[model samples]
Target: MAEDPESGGEKTEDASSRKLGKARDEGQVAKSVEIPSVFVLMAGVAAMYAFAFYFYQNLMGVFQFNYNFQGVPDFTRLEAIRLLYVHTEKILMTCLPVFGAVYLTALLANFAQVGFVVSWKALEPKPSRLDPINGFKQKFTSRAVVEFLKTLIKVGVVCLVCYYAIKGELTEISRLYDNSTGAILLFILKVSFWIFIKVCLIMIVLAFLDYAYQKWKFLEDQKMTKKEVKDETKQTEGDPMVKSRIRQLQHEAARKRMMADVPEADVVVTNPTRLAVALKYDREEMDAPRVLAKGAGPIAANIRKIARENDVPLVEDKELARNLYSHVDIGKEVPVEYYQAVAELLAYVYGLKNK
Candidate 1:
């Protein structure tokens, strides 16, 4: 059979092939990293501490050399050494918050996109996972291109903001040369505050952009082809072959039970071509006529053979046989509407037995 290309190149009627293909296509890694708000908060704290250390070292230099030192005491050496504490503290303080925020944001973004599902099924190693071609395809996809562009934009924006901010502060440096201590201290505080604000605004913008990209990537990855949807439905529900087999087994079991009751029949009625109905009647032992054995197709022919072997009468009643086969089952009483027809058939059979 020529395979339908729309059905994913498989000739089989199984819908799952298309579904599995869709799942594979959508499963490509388009993951996004969400930096948590806690990281930004920690970054802000680290920035404040950095500015404080800068102010402290410069103040220390002024105190050490004011009005009495023979030379500008080595402020450079002291500033450099003190910067070790500043850098170290900044890193230590920010590490937990920044990484924690990143982890939290990643979790939330993933949950929002895919729901809160913890399945080890997806983690199971497969032969496809080892394929270099698959890896290369993932690395060079449109999702990867978008991620690269996002990073570039964030870096460019932050650098531009920082450059403009520092450039505007250069003119204030000369005023600090002849100022009262209070004025110089105030100027340093103002410049530090502006820098902090600029960085915070840039960080906020970057975070928003990251979130938007995360949503877009998630939607793109979840889009499904029609064939994929049908295949998944079959896998999750059940295979048609298995269900059909189950029904066949049930029908065979029922047929055996009905045929076993054939020995008790008084007469077998047949449409000859399609139906056979074995009926039993007892005036004193039973209230109504009952079907002992009944069948159609091959089983119908078998019922007539059994009646012949047992010496039970075989009556040809096309209307009664067809009606009984259609409306009743083996071991069930004949319906009220069939009473007149069945009574006449039974009387004729009994009269023949008596003769």
Candidate 2:
């Protein structure tokens, strides 16, 4: 006897082919962080300070108490007690908005990237967590290199922005010697500008990094090897042998039920070796002709036997028998397509009963 391909020997080849195809099409590592929201929050902080400074200078002017002498003699206290209140108020204003922007941007970035799924499966303790080999593999991967570069670039950009901001404020600091009060106020403005620029640069860089990581992670997670697909299928659906056995058992049970009900049938329609369907009907009790049993192959042979044993009539119209067997179940009404054939079968049975 020829060996079946699905029995065992050829199964490994099927699994291997599936695994290789999936690996070629879908294997990549995911990124681990949110970058964009951090950047937006940083920008928001900068904007807050800029707006606060603008309001402060316009609302409460700097306090200046002066003492004039021939050769630069004495100095009186230039009380900035009111300026303190303005500065604190500005800081608070800047902080609140920055915080709000950070929060909203974080929410949006998180939503856009991973969606709302909050499963703890990834965080569950596994051997992979402690395995140094896995850690080494991840470290050497392209994903790790990209993350390192991203962080380096972010730091570099912020440092460069701070350096230039301070350079621009040098002249304002120098002018403080001649016009002490005005120069002091200008210095404060310059410092605020420098801080704002630094904050903005950091935020923008972080946001860009976040967006890049999100895209990278999405692509990586979506990757799947052929092997992985097959494995997933096996896990979700059971082994082929087990599935086939279950189907066979279910078919056997159905056949036994149909055979038991065959004697109740008014008529058995047969396509000889291929199909058998036994139908039951009553004019007063039934709205339509109902199939009492149906089968193919050996079950069909058994159905014919049951009908003959009970003295129920057997009809052999190939087309009508096949249609009835295909479309109606053992306990259900015949479908519309088989209505005429079933009605004729029922009429023949009734005439025989009356005779």
- Which candidate leads the pack in TM-score? 2
lDDT of each structure?
A: 0.71, 0.67
Show the lowest summed lDDT stretch of 10 residues, model 1. 29-38
Residue 246 lDDT in model 1? 88
lDDT of 1 by residue, 182-292 (tens): 677767667766766766667666766776776665544444555655666668777778888989999989888877778778889998768999999988977889988
Candidate 2 local lDDT, 92-130, one digit each (tens): 663665567677876776666545545455456788779
Q: Quick one: how many clashes does candidate 2 have?
A: 12
Candidate 1 has what TM-score?
A: 0.53
| Model 2, runs deviating above 4 Å | 1-47, 50-144, 181-186, 194-206, 271-274, 335-347
TM-score for each prediction? 0.53, 0.64
